[model samples]
Target chain A: MEALLEFLSFQDPSVRMVTLGAVILTASSALVGSFTFLKKKALIGDAVAHAVLPGVCLAFLLSGEKNPLLLIIGAFITGWLSLNIIDFVTNESKIKEDTAIALVLSVFFGFGILLLTFIQHGDYAEQSGLDHFLFGQAASLVGEDLIIFLSVGLLLIALILLFFKELTLISFDRQFAQTSGLPVKWLELLLTSMTVLAVVIGIQAVGVVLMAAMLITPPAAARYWTDYLPRMVLLAAIFGAFSGFSGALISYVSPAMPTGPWIVMVATTIALLSILFAPARGIIFKMKRQQENQLKILTENILKSFYHLGQKHQDMKHRYSFDEIHSIRPSIPKPRLKKGLRVLEKEGFLRKKENSYRLSAEGTEKGKRVVKLHRLWEVYLTEYLYLDPDHVHDSAETMEHVITPELEKKLEEMLNYPDRDPHDEEIPYT
Target chain B: MKKKILQADNPVTEVHDLTVTYDRKPVLWDIDLTLPKGSVIGVMGPNGAGKSTLIKAMMGLLPLASGYVKMFDEKLDDVREQVSYVPQRGTVDWDFPALVKDVVLMGRYSKIGLFKRPRQSDKEIAMDCLRKVNMEAFAERQISQLSGGQQQRVFLARALAQHADLYFMDEPFVGVDMATEKAIVDLLQEMSAKGKTVVVVHHDLQTARQYFDWIVLLNTRLVASGPTKEVLTDELLAETYGGKLTLLNEVSQEIKNKEFPNREE
Candidate 1:
């Protein structure tokens, strides 16, 4: 906690440099990674990240020291090479792209490990800290590394903001963009280059093994929150920056922890939370929506059964017994039917008198609307779709619960305000 | 190469000796076609009959193996701004994060050009196009919330926002509801009435006769291309869709085998 406070205060120069560098690195990666996630190329980021490892090790061995410029150039070249190889393998042979990605990822990562082991065993002072590149050592980030990361990261974010529309157009619909006279191929190349650069810049803080996680997880988690591209990009950048600061703070508190794994852990947690709890698209919300629909359908069916009985008896306020309602829909379990009735009574939509149930004024209005929509939809199917009157009832049963009030109004207008359905039933409406 | 001099002054689209190859197999064989201004033309064919390939080739989305396409008596690149395309709905990711209005605004992107953002006038034009398709209420909704027919209408609205002189649509009526189908047909007639050239890749043969004024029946080779009353004969439909085009199929297979000797399909 003291170390975190110290880091935030910027009193310690080294801690400030590491924190700032982590933020810049992750923000840029998330910016470029949004498009990669949209492009459905999540594994491509993995391949490129792993592929840049051997290039970093080679740069270390050739320069005999940690030269950030040489390492970035080396990483970019190898990353670009691996991307082409994946494309080439997919285009040439019968091998699919996923298999090709797996192949290149393993091969390049294996080569990087081999080079890393060689550098670790050498009798040199500078080679001692080279192993830090495998699992990132953000605690070791210096002033020089911060400068390189900041400049390149700003360049990446700038390019993305400038060509945001073109990238989004290409990502969503490539064929449409091409037909619209946009230079799609060059734009694609530029996007891929930005992705490669992001992976390269991110490797220092998150390292080769966990870089793809930072690239893919933020955008994927952000997707659950928005349906706008610009907002999604901004949210992903914020999420990435949050993960970076948390990872850096944890590493600073404990000298034994690595920044890469902690960063991935934070991102994974965010993604899991997004999947479980986001509104409209999340698993919890989807299940909740399904349950609500089932309850709605049940309530509507009971009300509709009441309407049928009332119509048969020629009495709008007629009461019906449990046995009679059960006979109306035999498929609903007994307990579920009781539960539906209890819920309706609780909501003041129905009134219980001894063993029979009758609709309240609110319940009657709601039930009439349901019946009106169902019968109207039935008439529409029969009149326009030419369906037999017998076949339209089963479809209208499902549509009655799902159709919104707006669609029901449209249906009424389209049917020219008909009062009777094809089966000669009255569409009750006030 | 016999050039048809008739209607040379105002031909909307002209294709000469066009052939498209996919994996060394000819999809659209040597085709010569010309369309006049202000007509709803149907490019009718069966599945795998290069109906989509022909539309894509004209828009320069697909690489042509041979020949060229001329629009407004000029090369396609010279007048690309005047052309708009609505590709197959199945080709795009419906789950992509974009609002209906943002998608319609993309139709104005070509006019908006690079770097600069879309202005207020552009937004107004996009909304106007949405109103034409009766989707103004859904302008702010995510595209995935739309029904299949509504999605098709949204694509039509995007194309309408382009305000182009020539429009190429691939399978605009497939999987759409009855109301959307009627709406699209009415929009096509309205556009044609205003002197716009619209070409649709139609699948249903029964409606093709009534929906379009001119039809281009294609099955690898051009079976017929003329006015609907003149070219939509029972015999031409048989050649275009039935097994009567087996010879053309065999010839295409032979060409594939000869040109790509070592390649496998």
Candidate 2:
């Protein structure tokens, strides 16, 4: 706890520079990455990340020192070139974008690794921190390097804000943007430049190999939580900054763990949690909704069977044995049938006498509504769709529990309040 | 290539020798046609007959191998606000995070310009367009929640929000319900009545005559372009459908077969 507090305090310049550098690198790339993710170009971000290694090595060799500005310029050039090569190859040949990405990343990255080997073997005095670019050394982020990353990060964020709508329109519908005279070519060039610039700055903190995680994970995690673009962008920025903070802080306190992999790990953990727990779109919530729907259908089907028996025997209050109900609803498995009965009884929808069950007054009304919906849908299918009476039952069987009261009213009016269904059975009254 | 190519003296849209190529192969051959102002025109062709390629080329969405398109006697870049396009419904991802209203509001962005967010009045216009398509109640719903017919209706509403002098629609009625078809046709008629021209790339033969005032029939090349009565003739339709015209030709052939009783049956 004391180490964490000490690391967080601005009294230490190295710790402050490291944390802010990680934060800006992540937040800016996440902002740009949201659009790339939306455009379904997540793979392109990965390719660009890998392809920038040659640019960094070339920048180091030419400058003969670790100059942040020269490195960014060189990295930006090769990163931008990588995307153009992918486009050029895909357009000119039968090679698709994926294959093009693979080929370019391998050639560029292989060349970078070769150059890195030569530099390591050679007697270079200023090559002490050069190898840190491979795995990333956030704890070693200097003040001058932090300023360069900050300036570029702010530039990226400003450009995104200035052209948010235009970028959105183009990403969502490029042809529409063209038809509207939005200068799609210029906008595309601008976006491509922004993407390259973002990747260039982000590669310093997360390194080339793991730079894509900063770009892809935050936005992907944010998408699960919101359906609005601005909100999604904001949430992605927050998630990215938080992961950057955690990664920097962990490495700062421990001094042994690499910052790049830790950032990726934290971002991935957030993505997994978002996928499982976010409302409406989350896996767990979706499964919960499905289970609830299945249970409701099961319980309603059981009640519907009871309603059928009472109408047949003219004994609304008579309790039927579990065996008797099973004979009618044999489609429901034995275990599920018992569970459904228990749910209905516990919910006050069924009056239970030992192992047998009958509908309560409220349960009887609800059962009547479900039956009415089934018969009404049947009448609609047969009368309007020209379907045979038998063909209508299967469709109505599923739709009975799905229809809402407002839709039921509309169906009633559209079908003109049919008295009897195609089955020659009277539809239950309201 | 025919003298029947409907060239209006004062055309709303004019295409001169427009050729579109896909992967260096010409998909839409040299096509010269003109659209009259305040008319609902239909371009009908069999599948892969370059029906969509023609409109996309004219709108400058595709690279023109040759030729140019002019609207109101001005280049497309000069009069963009006076023109609008609705691409095929399935052209974009329906699962994209947006409300029905947000998409409709995109149509107003041409006037909204760059860097400026949509204002309250722009939103009101989008709402009004949604109301015109009978989708005002669904303005708040996510686009992915819409059915095929409802999505088509929303596309129509987006185009309506443009309020352009000329409109281009690709396969607007395909895969839609009878009510949606009726609603879109009625909306088209209403637009024409208000002195706005609509050019639809249509494929259905049964409803072509009723849906459009002018018809352009194509089969990789222009077969006919004139009034609906003249363009939809039996010979022209047979030429447009080509030898693979299965559904219409089979029905007509069956009618003749039934009359003659010449089959083995």
- C-alpha lDDT score of every prediction, in listed order: 0.88, 0.87
Q: Single out the weakest 10-residue window by summed lDDT for candidate 1 chain B.
A: B1-10
Q: Where does candidate 2 chain A have its weakest 10-residue lDDT segment? A: A128-137
With candidate 2 superimposed using the best TM-score fit, by how many Å does residue A271's alpha carbon deviate from the native? 1.2
Instruction: Give the lowest summed-lDDT range of ten residues in model 2 chain B.
Output: B256-265
Candidate 1 deviant stretches above 4 angstroms: A1-10, A297-346, A350-360, A364-430, B1-9, B243-251, B254-265
Give the lDDT of residue B142 in candidate 1: 93
Fnat for model 2?
0.74
DockQ of every candidate structure: 0.77, 0.62
Off by over 4 Å in 2: A8-13, A320-335, A353-357, A385-393, B1-3, B243-265
CAPRI verdict on model 2?
medium
